[model samples]
Target: MAAEVKLAVRGAGKRYGEMDALKDCSLDVAPNSIVSIVGPSGCGKTTLLWSMSGLHGLTSGEVLLDGRRITGPHPDIGLVFQEANLLPWRNLMDNILFPFEVKHQKPDHGWIAHLLERVGLTGFEKNFPNELSGGMQQRASIVRALSLRPSVLLMDEPFGALDAFTREEMNQLVEEIWMETHTTIVFITHSIEEALFLSDKVVVLTPRPGRVLNTYEVPFERPRTMEIMAGKEVYDLTYRIKADIYGQSRMQARAAE
Candidate 1:
């Protein structure tokens, strides 16, 4: 069964001086479900995430978690950035436990071990980020985020830096962990295929002064594979989204001339 709504952004807007980065943006995210946000470059995808994370407050509207307002960073929200951002000097174990240390919360070794095993970094606890492969480093970074045991995970282009092959592997890993942990996730990406593959719902945003263009409910069953990308339904959806984004880009250019 699908989960209940756990996070929401209601009429959220953020402005930088005279520029509006996000305007009247709102979304309801379900518990234990994955939502992907996609948009053209400079469309405030990252800005929306920053607002949701409570790293920056919205100039208008609100972000809610469990029905309460998000005034700032909370323990229940965990963020993973585009880079793995692991400390080069810290070993896998130490790096994963870093969040707890900063939060002044007691480290849960058992939970940490479980996450390491789940992400396939079980025996490499002693290895530094430099000692791990790109995929492995990312896995460790995920473990670090999960260590907080946050109800929601916000990921911003987490795999955008990896090669195509490694990115696919990381996708599979994320799928496995999401299923196991039932954590709500809001992921931002430029790839429509990635959005389709990883999301329960996909939100496409318009160009700057960003607003929702459309939201799609992904219909494919779980345990999804790369082969699903080749299906006619997936192809049609991909084509339509690309056309929508391209169409908007041209419109914006024409207006600027």
Candidate 2:
């Protein structure tokens, strides 16, 4: 374990004009643990990820990485957006090396190759984004993010666009990567099953002007699988989270009315 606290969000808030996307949200991610955020739409889950990555400025509070305040993006944090966002003109290897290029650092071919292999993109290194399947493209994108050797990985619905089978496979892939690297991960998702399957803790949020509704610790043992997910304990946790999100959505509707 790296330390007790890998990332900490304290009173974190973000606003767009009159709209408060997040408010008074606080959470601590233990080192090398997998944490997932789940909530109704417009609940600022993505904003929280952006704030943690320093991609968006915070209106108040602070995001700390390994006890240091993150005033701006740090090289040790990697983000995987919903879209693969791969450049059509670039080959897989080139795309994975893009981060080093932007930072004006020399490309680490060895690490890039290793990441490609890890993501199962070893044979497609010279292929363009258009030549790959949706799942493969996302795999490449993940490898690109990991190429920087980030200690913390921030994922915002990275598997949302894929088909159900593909999404499930990607979920397993993420778990495999986490187990292999012991990297701290904060994933945002709308799927209760996915969150329950992969997370050590699932943080539930309310609708806009989001606040932490609850945090559920997954009692299942590590190295989770589809079999574990079929267990009653896992199903119960998923049902509970689903109910929380449903209730929050209803509350938002009433408040708007």
Candidate 3:
């Protein structure tokens, strides 16, 4: 009857050559919950995501999904990166189905169609990536990630490249999709507002060799509205997180000098 522990990182660490990207990082994600990772630029947020997705091997510790070790890129996990990364030659439908094609499997047309509609790309199936706006293309990429019904969705700055309005729209769309599907999500971003708006739990990280500085629970009720962000509670929490992140930067600078 209890919610399951969907994904976990235990004593996880990553390094590239002489540079340590993450150190002693650990977190747990519950099924059907959304967790956001936030930090300043170059804080190893992407490295953490790569480790979770098994795209990069960790220097220490482990990433577990459903009690099993994630040794490599598992099929049950879906990832959406900063760029839409759609195939220029393939139309929307084909691009969305590209994952299935690569695995020599047939895609579920019914579900694919439904996802297209959910992401507002219903009639644009035949259109190429170049033919669509940046926001539309990103939506298609998101739908593609979700079309596979991944048990865990890993998004690394998926909307970071979009304009302000588009980013906010996509944030709402993400919330809608998460509510509908109940899929576990680990979203990484640099924006405090984005983290506060979309996360059930926001994990703050330190700079360079990133470490968990704090984890804040977002108490805002869902089916969240834009107006909710204007409340005193929301502003206070955002300010707190902003202070924690900036404070860490100052500490790091002091240690360096």
TM-score of 1: 0.95
Cα error of candidate 1 at position 160, Å: 0.5
Give the lowest summed-lDDT range of ten residues in model 2.
219-228
RMSD of each: 1.9, 1.9, 1.5
How many steric overlaps does candidate 2 have? 0
lDDT of 1 at 65: 95
Cα lDDT of candidate 3 equals 0.92
Which runs in model 3 stand beyond 4 Å of their true positions?
1-3
lDDT of each model, Cα atoms only? 0.90, 0.91, 0.92
Query: TM-score, each model?
Result: 0.95, 0.96, 0.96
- Which lDDT tens digits does candidate 1 get at residues 52-147? 999999999999998899999988999998889999989988998888888788998899899988988999999988989988888899999999
Give the poorly placed runs of model 2, Cα more than 4 Å off.
1-3, 255-257
| Best candidate, TM-score | 3
Candidate 2's residue-wise lDDT over 172-194, tens digit each? Answer: 89989988899999999988888
**Best-matching candidate per lDDT:** 3
Superior candidate under TM-score, 2 versus 3: 3
Clashing pairs in 3: none
